[model samples]
Target: MGAVASQDKQATLKGSEPSVAPLMRLVEPGMARVNALILEMAGSHAKMIPDIARHLIDSGGKRLRPMLTLACAEACGYSGENHVKLAAAVEFMHTATLLHDDVVDESELRRGKPSARMLWGNQASVLVGDYLLGQAFQTMVQVGSLDALAVLSKAASVIAEGEVLQLVAAKNLATGEEQYLKVINAKTAALFSAATEVGPIIAQSTADMRRAMAEYGTQLGLAFQLVDDALDYGGSSMTLGKKVGDDFREGKVTLPIVLAARAGTTEDRTFWSRTIEHGEINDGDLERAIDILRKQGAIAATVERARSYGDKAIAALAALPAGAHRDALEEVVLYCISRVS
Candidate 1:
């Protein structure tokens, strides 16, 4: 498909009305600059680096984290050019994580296409991911705001720690909600909080505003991940870009499984242990897993948790001034929750 048609396909993946379209509309101009910077920064003489990076970059993610940076900065009255650089940096960090993640997950598809690792090999994917991190840092330095740099740099570390935590926790049925939250907060929410927090930091907004933005992004990130886990079982390949039950196949102990396992009967517990803990998943196992999740109210519970976080994300915006940008930010929280509904 053509570029515009491709983007339209991505936008409509959620249904007749895409949740993120409003946020995209509000941030399109700023996003244009960020996109330009992304392309400029992704260039390299090695050719392989840029080729692999572009394969992922040009893939049809909504660029939600970077958009959060631009939107929050706009809401905080930041007209400075640094926001564009920071937004690009946010995207680089995110893209780098995805590259690394697909390698770790051994995922074949990303955003409805072959993953970078699938085409380029694991070694190249890892090196390209490192290259992206270098580019992300360079862009942050160009902004020349130590505060923004500190927030993002710290987030980069936290994201790595989160990745490690997930690795250690992977396939362990004993993994509780608390451990799971720490994993998601570090891997997912840390970048989000950093993306939004750096905006206010660059704008030199009040401490309260910065804190509020951090909270908003943190909660929103949690909600985003929760919905993603829910979708793995309930959504389609068209929506998720991978086959449904990929997570189950991979033995990831996400929230729905965690909840369902906890509430399961002895027989159900044995089933989880055999499939998730032991990796003995068979054909019909995914369907049985979904039934167990439904019977335990795990799916509904997961969505409820997401809704609670979405409410908190919205509540954080109250500290900011009333305006279209702020309203759009609030809509983003709703948009996130709407994916499951």
Candidate 2:
């Protein structure tokens, strides 16, 4: 397929996302000049943490959150070292959440490696996640931006709320769009929204501009997650670095499945409602769900929803003046929706 058509046919990421292999191309020195800061953050008390923390820390994620902060700051015309600290803080917070989530979900894997909870035991994993969160707050203090700190705190609180919401509403089978939105906003979008807004907050941008960044982040976060939900069914386990159909096994009630369950034929409904919805999913259940999702058009519908968010992200960026940084940000929107590897 041609590049544009290939992107257009991505699993559920029906819009633009920077491709994984070439994300560095979208990021310039402006986005990448903070690796040392991250190393320093991890260096403070190295030996105390041990291999578990080291394992997760070494996984080499795409670092999308930090990149958002850097690119947004540059786009908004901020030039300083503070964004580095902020980016590191966001990463720590995100990584911390992943640890806690693995423990809570009893997940065995992360980023294609043994989860912290798996390798180090649940107690160690939970404590380390806590440590990362505390360390994140400490970094915030060092930056000396109370406003930024407030943003981080709010984001953290929202994330916690989202997790709680998901747990409370996990398998109702009637999780409406509103409830799902709440879960998604808390679980994923909160940080994306916060990271993007951090740039404006750090630069002391005008209120309107700050809101624009927040909108952009919120839309991107939603799009990112919608694609993630789609990937749960269609994406490869190797590419995602976690188990395929993990959400189904966990009974997470993501959007595609939600729509699929509703649209299923009576027999299809019987199996999914009794087995998958109850988290009793077994052999071939995933294959069955994929078949139902395809038949019901749930997968494509979910991808369309993701594309809407991508469009909204681009619309949010329209207010910003044109520049390489802005163009890079726009490309990121496309790439997020297109990424498979």
| TM-score, one value per model | 0.94, 0.90
Report the lDDT tens digits of candidate 2 across residue range 69-136: 87787678788988888988998899889998998888988988888776678998888788778888
In terms of lDDT, the poorest run of 10 residues in model 2 is 1-10
lDDT of 1 by residue, 1-341 (tens): 22243234335545644367778898899999999889999999999988987888888788999999999998899897899999999999999999999999999989889889889899999999999999999999988999999999999999999999999888999999999999999999999999999989988999999999999999999999999899898888777777788899888999999998888999999999999889998889999999989888999999888888887887788888998787678778777777777
How accurate locally is residue 106 in candidate 2, as Cα lDDT from 0 to 100?
87
Clashes (backbone N, CA, C under 3 Å), per candidate, total 0, 12
Alpha-carbon error at 13 in model 1, in Å? 20
For model 2, state the Cα shift of residue 278 in Å.
Answer: 2.3
What are the lDDT figures for the candidates, one per model? 0.88, 0.80
Clashing pairs in 1: none
TM-score of 2: 0.90
> What ranges in model 1 sit over 4 Å off?
1-18
Worst 10 residues of 1 by lDDT: 1-10
What is the Cα-based lDDT of residue 212 in candidate 2? 92
